[model samples]
Every structure is written in structure tokens, then in C-alpha cells.
Target: FQFCSTRHELGSIILTTNLDFDKWPDVFGDARMTEALIDRLTHRADIHVMNGESYRFRQTLELRKRVAKEN
Candidate 1:
């Protein structure tokens, strides 16, 4: 209810989600919540699925090399 009602009233949102639509119900809890939420957002949203090796891990190695250069 909260998820659906707010977006309907406000008309826009920014959400960062790691799961695809098939997995939405797991987070939202049930079909009704998932259904209603998807209904509202689907019409106006742009889904961006980001895929690749994690930048967090890549950056850690890069940072280590930079620190070694400094030493």
C-alpha cells in the first residue's frame, strides 16, 4: 500500500534495485503489493539493469597499487 500509493500520488521515483522483475515479490512480500507497485511504475519508469564485476573490488586493487606507488 505504501509503495503503490506514494508513487501514484507523487508521480515519480528513484529506486535502486539489484533484482529483476521476476524477483520483485521477494522484496515487496506478496503478489498484491508486487502487482500494484509494478503497475504504477511500469507505465513511467525506465528500468536499468547494471551488470559487470563489482567496482568495489576493482577499486580496492587499484587503490593498493596507487598506495604502493606512493611508498
Candidate 2:
């Protein structure tokens, strides 16, 4: 929170999270602080939401198939 507060408009910040904004409070454990942090971070930010199958999951499935074939 301090970092974001300090750099709110002075620099650029790139953040990526699998969790949604609504779920952030669960991680931060403080609803007010979470809201304030998000507000500061997103005040002038461009947001993007990506939805697709995970690459790691696909690779894991392929590895399992290969192991099954070997057995």
C-alpha cells in the first residue's frame, strides 16, 4: 500500500494477478486498505482481462498422455 501510495502518479507500475478485484480483500485481509490500494493503483491505469485455457494445464495433460503411452 505504501509503495502504491508513493508511486501513484510518479511512475509506471505493471501488475498481473489471477485473482479478481472483488477477491483482493480476501488476500489483503483489510477491506478498507484493499479498496484504497485498488483505488490508487487503478486511478489512471489501463486494465485488461485475459480469459483462456492455462498453458501449464495443457502441458500437464500432454505429459500425462505421454506417460500413459510409455506404460
Candidate 3:
């Protein structure tokens, strides 16, 4: 958190998580800290809210079916 907040100008950080901002405190273990982190992270970010099953999850099921058929 300190690293990202202090040195954000150094580069970019990409984070992928299923949790939303309201639920971030569970991961950070501090509501205030999580709010601060969200503030800094979203200051100049292009956020994308993705829905539906993840591509990798869907692909894994397909791969398993293909292997079963081969067996």
C-alpha cells in the first residue's frame, strides 16, 4: 500500500480481484486504509467492471470435456 501510494508516479499497477470497493476492507483488514487505497488507485485509472464467468474458468471446463472424450 505504501509503495503504490508513494511511488505511483514511477509506473503502473494492475490489480484483478473479484471484490468490490465496499468489500476491500476485508482484504486490507482496515476500512480506512482500504478507502485510502481505493482513492489513490482510482484517481487516474480506467476501471472496468467485468461480469459473467471468467474466460479461463470457461476454458478449463471445455478442456476437461475434450480430455474426457479423448479418454
Candidate 4:
């Protein structure tokens, strides 16, 4: 909270989170604070939402297939 507050309009912050805004309270443990943080972060920001399978998970599946074939 302090970090975002200090850098609210002073600098640029790149934040990447898998969870949605509504689920932030689960991680932050404070609904009000999470709301404030989201407000400050999105005030003058360009938001991007990327939806797809995780590269790591896909790679793991490929590795398991190769291992099973070799067995």
C-alpha cells in the first residue's frame, strides 16, 4: 500500500497478477486497502488482460508425453 501510495502519480509501476480485482482481498487480507490500491493503480493506467494456457503447464505436459513414450 505504501509503495503504491508513494508512487501513485510520481512514477510508473508494472504489476502482473493472475487474480482478478474482486479476488484481491483474499491475498491482501484487507478489502478497503485492496480497493484503494486498485484505484490508484488503474487511475491513469492502460490495463491488459491475457487469457491462455500457461506456457509452463504446456511444457510439463509435453515432457510427460515424451517420458511415457520412452518408458
Maximum-lDDT candidate:
2
lDDT of candidates 1 onward, in order: 0.81, 0.95, 0.88, 0.94
Candidate 1, pairs of clashing residues: none
| Of 2 and 4, the candidate ranking higher by TM-score | 4
Candidate ordering by lDDT (highest first)? 2, 4, 3, 1
Candidate numbers, best TM-score first, in rank order: 4, 2, 3, 1
Top TM-score hit: 4
Q: Report the Cα lDDT for candidate 1.
A: 0.81
- Candidate with more favorable, higher lDDT: 1 or 3: 3
Better of 1 and 3 by TM-score: 3
- Candidate 2 per-residue lDDT over residues 25-57, each given as its tens digit: 999999999999999989888999989989999
Task: Name the weakest run of 10 consecutive residues (lDDT summed) in model 2.
Answer: 3-12
State TM-scores per candidate. 0.66, 0.87, 0.82, 0.89
lDDT of 3: 0.88
RMSD of 2: 1.2
- Model 4 misplacement above 4 A: none
Per-structure clash totals for the candidates? 0, 0, 0, 0
